[model samples]
Target chain A: MTPPPAPVDDFDLHGYVDHQLPPARREEVATYLAANPEAAARVADYQSQNQALGAAFEGVLAEPVPPAMLTRRRPWLGAITRIAAALALLFTGGTAGWLAHDSLLAPSAIERTVAEPAAYAHRAFAGEFRHPVEIWGDNEPHLVTWLSSRLGMPVRPPDLNQAGYWLVGGRLLPARGGAAAQFMYQDDKGGRITLYVRTGIIGNSESRFQFFDQQGVRLVYWVDGPVGYALTGPVDREHLLHAAQLAYGQTKR
Target chain B: MDDIAQQISEQIPHLRRYARALARDRTRADDLVQDCLERAWSRLHLWQPGSNLKAWLFTILHNLHANQVRKLKRALDNVPLSESHLSASTPATQMQQLEVKGITDALQRLSEEQRAVVLLVGLEEMSYQEAAKVLDVPIGTVMSRLHRGRERVRQLLADQGQPVLRRVK
Candidate 1:
């Protein structure tokens, strides 16, 4: 016999079965269930199944734990510790190799000769405030002509508009070789970048980029054509490279 | 040592039972209980002196068990449903065998949220509010999931051609 369709009010049935209904509502559902024999039987089955399921898994709570698991450190901690140690070793090895290479190649000796103008440029602006540069960016043509004449070499201040920095000004300083030129630029965020140029006489003529940090300032030194250019700033390496690339591209054009 | 250890020791069995019900593995469940005990021992200051220590410990066990399940799921991507079955230590007796097996199988098929509601309400004998707190869900959600989970289990058992006993009003 097909039993009459169960008149299950989904929400009330849920609330009733879950014991969420108030005492008064609970009594109402109880009365309703009393009238429906088949539904009451189904509810009993549900209650029995729920009880049996709970009993089946409840014994697991009483079981004693082995000592090993209590003391076992998390695997991630060990893996991270090993990775940190390996990274420390790698950093040490790299530093040692760099020191060894520096001593063998003795780039410092060559740097001492070619980098005098860069140092002089650094000292010239070390404590300057309002008027660090001799010629302002407004007099670009005269500034370029004056710097070129003083250094005895063709010089052009790299246009940095594409790199989000506008030309600020230029300064001429005395160096080991002769006159050194410093051109400065400023980005929108008030970050100032300086480019130092001087005559190159060192036999090492190959173009190379070197990263160095002095105090809080970072510098990227490189040689292109005949000019020794040192890009210095407190900006990150990537940003400095981006600015340098823009400057270099403009100079070539 | 004796008094303090005894108090903690007493709660261990209940914690273990809840953990076992949650995890379904003896070793994993016990490990969860141990973690809970150790955590409770260290953070005993957070425990209200006369509050329900059993419930507090069960809450800790539940959180730990849930986290472990999440981590296991992440590690074992595309894991088969059958492999996640709870291996209960209960003997496979003929009388309760079908009911026990059917319930366990149905429980496994439930979503974690639904299973949590069923375990807390059906197994733990917790009220709707208490089960909601343990599962960290709304009381309404608890009721809804419990209702749905129970109906699903009935449907699943019925599909297995279990004898349908008539409801007694």
Candidate 2:
């Protein structure tokens, strides 16, 4: 017996495997496969591959989430900033105390602008092939000093190599009450996540790790004293969330 | 909980299932799902009320998966996939020639787009249209990729040569 020529086109076969064919078209595929034992074997293989893929990770859903994963701890940068605040307090004795003290206080709600601007900046900048950032991270010392001087505070780009994100660079932008800095980070995979930080007065109390997704970009942001930081990515919410957490943690120190 | 929150919550198990299928490792999959949930919670306002929550969740998962695959691919670049020695060794399996390990190994070798296409269609049982939406690709692209992906998996499984109990055809 002679074997029939291979199905030159697989649109129908693929459609059949993916359940995309119309009823009549499905019948056509079935008829074609029946006469061709080779095609039938191929269908059988596709079916089994699907089964194996589906069954492969079935147990993962049932596994309990480790207790630690459900909760997050934020030291709020208490150690590093508090000590500096205390040292400054020792120098500025009484009259200037309240003013300096107020400056060190937790960021207020009105002062914290996280998701919208961050997402906005991500959309505006991250996709740009030419200029993703104004001051590239390669010029680390210069970038920090320039941004620090502009924001009227010492600014350091958050280190995120541990979290698999690297500081790519940053660009300055306008934000609520004052100037904002958007810091970009990229992984070896060429995926980019950005940290948007700004300083100014916000009237409301501090925000917890708030999240926002807009225009297909996801972000998580929070405000510490005198600084509002948001981590943005075009990736999924989870990735941005973790990247945000890492950014927050790294920036804290 | 608000309506959107409630709806988003209902999609978690399914999200976990999809993440697990995508990631293949238990810990990594759960981490992905958990991050997705927290992100979804914070971004609840972004989701249009009365929209398709499952599709939204799947989209989020796909984005996360894509990022991770890029990272993995970067790592794979350091130690080339060709050196993995997957082809020469096919582990014994009673059920069929290619078991979960072999299948997953083959999948890891496929391009991210191809993996997403097949898993969405095969594991999630999404229609070509739904899979296309999740993947942000056209229906024609989905079909072509699915065909290419399925064809590759077949070739890989055949090369792995797990002892199929019998060839039915």
lDDT of 2 by residue, A157-193 (tens): 8788876788888877876445778888877667777
List of clashing residue pairs for candidate 2: A109-A204, A110-A202, A110-A203, A110-A204, A111-A202, A238-B35, B97-B162
**Which CAPRI quality tier does the interface of model 1 achieve?**
incorrect
- For every candidate structure, what is the RMSD over all alpha carbons to the true structure, in angstroms? 23.9, 12.5
User: lDDT per prediction?
Assistant: 0.62, 0.65
lDDT of 1 by residue, A169-192 (tens): 898876553567898887675556
- For candidate 1 chain A, the 10 contiguous residues with the lowest summed lDDT are A96-105
Q: Give DockQ for candidates 1 onward, in order.
A: 0.10, 0.17
* TM, every model: 0.46, 0.50
lDDT of 2 at A165: 81
Off by over 4 Å in 2: A1-9, A64-253, B1-3, B71-100, B163-169
lDDT tens digits, residue span B136-162, model 1: 778788878987878887888779787
**Strongest candidate by DockQ:** 2
Q: Which ten contiguous residues of candidate 2 chain B have the minimum total lDDT? A: B77-86
The regions of model 1 sitting more than 4 angstroms off are A1-22, A58-253, B1-8, B78-100, B163-169
